[model samples]
Target: MGTFSAMHYRCLMPHKPSAHVRRPTPQRPMRVRWWLLWCAMWCLCGAPALAQPAPKVLRYAMVSDATTLDPVSFSDIYSVEVAGSIFEPLYRFDYLARPVTVKPQLAAALPEHSADWREYTVHLKPGVFFADDPAFGGQRREVVAADVVYAIKRIFDPRWKSPQLPNFAAMGLTGLNAVRQRALDQKTPFDYDAPVEGLTAIDRHTLRFRLDKPDPRFIFSLTGTVAAAPVAREVVEHYGDSVGDHPVGSGPFVLASWRKGSQIVLARNPGYREVHYDEEASPDDAEAQAIAQALHGRRLPMVDRVEIAVIDEEQPRWLSFLQQGLDLVLLPGTFAPVAMPGGRLAPNLQRQGIVAQKLARPDVVYTVFNMDDPVVGGYGPAQVALRRAIGLGYDNDEEVRNVRRQLGVPAQSLVPPSTYGYDPALKSEMSTYDPARANALLDLYGYLDRDGDGWRDRPDGSPLVLQYHTDKTLRPFNELWKRRMDGLHLRIDFVPGQWTEQAKAARAGKLMIWFLSWNASAPDADEFLRLAYGPAIGGDNLSRFNLPAFNALYDRQAEMGDGPERLATIAQANRLLLAYLPIKAHVHRLQVSLHWPRLQGYQPHPYLRPFHAYVDVVPNPVNP
Candidate 1:
């Protein structure tokens, strides 16, 4: 392992020819026909050089395959950024991971909520434009308020049938539930019949949303990638099924092209505006300054073009990075700090480096046991006994230190660190590995090895076979689990399956035991509640665990206005989830990323957030 060279040592100098010379005599006649070109060439020769030269292109890799390019359809981080580049969102999470401010390119200001917290009003920034539309023969149209209303309504449209319907209640629109009910009642054409009393088109520049209940995080919910973006109504209605392939958005980057499973290309949007504007400067001046900053330093869309190459495997990407084939390799959370060739990076910098510099952004990893197994009687004695035993047998501290390379903190609560209202008291309840406690629980629950065949049996003389539905990624953890269970005469069956099949089975509640982790949006309790206690579509609640008390707190949190009341409610929900032990909170896993020295402004984001921007990347070559 080597420490990266301190970034300060790198120098930026513009490349300039050592000497200037007069043009060749034969070229003089050609200049007569192109006088403007000749004059521009002469002026360039006299001008002073800059300290830094702009990069022409950016190339990077995505770990997970993008499910879709449609913001309304995809939920993965990769898809959001891919779609985000093409579609402008009303707001985006700030560097601190708070949804307090607007991105400004699409949204002009933070949404204003009524005193009752039921209604929201958003004013559009003037004169922002989308990508050139073929329908309009390459003419860019100014973004309007109607586009905002249409985008939100499209989520609930029966024709679109988006998976994001449940989240719309946060916007105070209750029409989706009615549409869902009508479908269940065998009604023809499950149209959105309920008049959305909450949403109003207050002219063409202002939009308002009225909620059925006072939601403290209503505005925060609207800040989601799906709701925050504005869609062209004509494109959506005209293209119909083909809209995703030919989408339109008002973001900093436009979708130049996408080659499925190969690469996605993006180009700068000419009409883009800065969210952070100098009030004294005109918008045109600000746009020009933004372009200059983007092409220069500190802030960037640093390159003229961006190419996101699709690379599924990590090792190949790592190999390419070592060979200098890649500009940067976005490492997933799986890899830890490893030795690198000193020649490639730097050797002496490795041994004395700060631990924080080598690690990834902190995130939690959890293992959820499926309590609703057909053989286990759905959270009955067998499943509870197994979960209790497993909880008491595994050493979380050791896993955090050894397996995760001390890059993570042991987590006992579902709520991750750095989030609002995360309680320290919740840490006390996590159970460490205690064989005696595990054995006692199993013994008390009627598990005994009466047959003396090295396998335990239940009170009814049936073998206590523990089946774990896992993937290859979890093989090491599975081995540890198997070894630990062996001491208690518990037979562990490691069932292997493809990742997709295993995930489908887990979602359907067909798996006996499985692993689950909430890669949260903001480390909030609501993030966990949505997956754990919200509505169970299938086996997603593998533990078959539900507490009305927890749901009540979540509901109360939704009803209560933002501030202390809501914060307390969230903390209570987190604490309750920990107490119930539905899932073992392992530790907050850090995302480890690698980059070439040429790249700059490579700040790490929280968890799985995709913060790719050409404005923020630059090369660190010792010399060109």
Candidate 2:
């Protein structure tokens, strides 16, 4: 799942320092004629002959700090994006592909799967070495198949309580779940040495995964965000709970320093293998082709150091970008109207050598009502009516136009556009905003103003206040929500808190209502649907929706291949979501970014977390 900042911004390319040649000091000052000739040559060539190059440092900013850097416990996309560079997933998506396609990462090539698609065998590339850390006793550590085995076991260790555990349900490894269950049942530490029938390290450079069932989409889990990224056992053991502070991996970059909730710095991994930059792209896609031509045969991670700072406020973040403190800035929606008016960069900004990338993110933002909360929870008709009325009362179109600065499309369903099973032609109550209809529904359901305090009460004459939990930055959104609820004579009170705390509270089902957004890690629309699945309530299904019919349909669709029948099943499931109103999908956000012209390979792809690896910061800031 993608985090909020990951949804909009990432990656600032690096600039290398120029090396100055010591020419015996021009100890003797040049004569007037020679100096004049040198000035003429400089004017003609447009570059000084002895100028030193800029240091290859990429300075970037994200709205929030990463909650942690441990791969097994990575909750938000910020953590995923940062840890991704330091860790080695067996596979990743092709960099320039429109629809995401699997590509080898630490693995030498794509895995060979059995005909039933229940098993996969991967061959790891030899010579890949983890960055040197104290955990390794100052010795080089080559990533092995055993490390992959150990990495997978960490998720099931029961100590991490990994939010990523729910993702493994789709994997259905033959004996892994049994080990997890045994630990849960006996209250014993997970036995990492237990011989699991599914996971195997055939050799130093080989891994084999055996599944209990067919899962053609299982390959996507190896994208490093899910479960299979290789983390050294010793590093995790050495750091213990503090492993998030010291990530050791066999990827492109190594963590140099970190100040929690402030800044993180990564230096190029000296142990990184000799990998060249190459990306697959459609021949007809000119943008991809151009990026390919620009970065052809360059070394991986052209940047020597990446400094990511946490600058949460929009105004300061924009100001920092304008003042050239940041090499690139992900445009917050509030400034979209001015920065990229009418879907193009402002001419004034464009003239300053600014370039922009507009991407249609495969994601959805929605309001989640806790189904287990006393005020909003229950399967009763009155509870359902309360939710439906609230869903109908809120104006998502207004949010898109005003709050989002016309940077989003009001969602018709949870499924985002440009992904499998997303139907652009379908329409639903999710896209409509009618206070009148909402009032009638509430009135019919006996949610009246028993106390006559200008706000309607619950059906049982209880106060009907929606204690909405959100970040302080959502004032515009909260104002609109309060106004909409006021129109329906319902009450809503905002509770502002830190994003990390609110997210924790959300997972524990301690909040009545909160805003949540999800970006697809893979191309499947099923990822969005998992948010409403009954069994995932404590995990991804924060809404705690447990309708039996909907649950049955979710299971049915999960088992089927991506075909017309599965699409029909998914559409039917969405109807139940609207009818029950556990979550109200508001929009599919548009990600707009602004970067300097010197930042090469600037295309933004949400699926690619290690974006800094491909982009390069040239010595010349004005041009690539």
Best by TM-score: 2
In candidate 1, what residue range of length 10 has the lowest lDDT sum? 6-15
Counting clashing residue pairs in each candidate, in order, gives 21, 8
Task: State each model's CA lDDT, in order.
Answer: 0.61, 0.84
Which digits, one per residue and each the tens of the lDDT, describe model 2 over residues 1-624?
A: 323233122221112335784444354553554566655654554442455665588888988888888888866878877888888788887788776678888889888999888889999988888998989998998989999999888888899987777767546778998999999999999999998878989989998999987777777777645357888899988999998888888888999999877889999998788888888777888988998987889999899999998988899889998988898998998899899889889999988888888888999999999999888888789999899999999999999999999889999999998788888898889979988899999999999999979999988898989899888778889999989998998888888898888887888889899987887788887788889988777678889888889988887887677789999999999889888889999999998889887677877885776687888888575553
Off by over 4 Å in 2: 1-53, 224-226, 621-624
CA lDDT of 156 in candidate 2? 82
List the candidates' TM-scores in order.
Answer: 0.76, 0.90
Backbone clashes counted, model 2: 8
lDDT tens digits, residue span 185-262, model 1: 775554433445566568777777777777656655655455457787777666778777777787666777888777
TM-score result, candidate 2: 0.90
